[model samples]
Target: AQSVTQPDARVTVSEGASLQLRCKYSYSGTPYLFWYVQYPRQGLQLLLKYYSGDPVVQGVNGFEAEFSKSNSSFHLRKASVHWSDSAVYFCVLSGNNYAQGLTFGLGTRVSVFP
Candidate 1:
C-alpha cells in the first residue's frame, strides 16, 4: 500500500515570491507520483506527474516537481507565484496495480497574497 503525507495544512506566500510544498510518501515499490490543484468550486486538475525516467517533471503555469526515490519525497515548486495560484494542492501516489486507484494526501491550501 502507498500513502502520502503533506505536513503543511496551509501555506501563505506573497505575490511574485517563490513557493515550495512538501510531500512525503511511503510505499513498498516504485510508485507513480502526481501533483494536483483544485480551485474554488472546481475539480482537481493535474499539475504534473512522475512515473519513471527523469526525476524532474514540468507542470502547468511554470510549476515543476522533483521526485526523490531515496528521500521518498516529491515536492512541488514554483519560482514565482501569483494571486491566481491560490488553491488547494494535493499529492497523490499510485501503486503498480491500476485498479487499486490512487492515494491522496490531505492537501495543502496555498494562499497567495498581494
Candidate 2:
C-alpha cells in the first residue's frame, strides 16, 4: 500500500541556482523517508532522512528537505547547485527495517549546467 511518486523525470538547472525536487508518498502508518544521490558509476548515498521530530532536515553538500504529513510530501531543496551535483536523485521509503528493502520512485535526473 506504500508507494512513492516523483513527478519529474528530469530536471535541468544552472550552476549556482536553487533547486527543488518533488516527492510524494503513500503510506498508512509512520514512514521512514530518504533521499539518495547517485553519481555516475557510484553507489547511492543518503542525502537526508526524515524519521521524527523536526520536519526540516539538513543533508550533505548543502541539501535539505522538509516533511509534510498533510500533503504526504517531502521535497528536497538546495540553495545552490554545482556541476558535480549532476546525478540521479531517488526518493525512497522504508516502513521499519532496512532489511525489508526499499520502495523507490521513478527517480529524477538532475543536470547542472555550467
Best by lDDT: 1
TM-score of each: 0.97, 0.95
Q: Give the alpha carbon lDDT tens digit for every residue of 1-114 in model 1.
A: 778999999999999999999999999998899999999999999999999999999999999999999999999999999999999999999998888799999999999999
lDDT of 1: 0.97
lDDT of the candidates, in the order given: 0.97, 0.95
- Candidate 1's TM-score reads 0.97
CA displacement after TM-score superposition, residue 64 of candidate 2 (Å): 0.2
Ten consecutive residues with minimal summed lDDT in candidate 2? 94-103
Query: Which pairs clash in the backbone of model 1?
Result: none
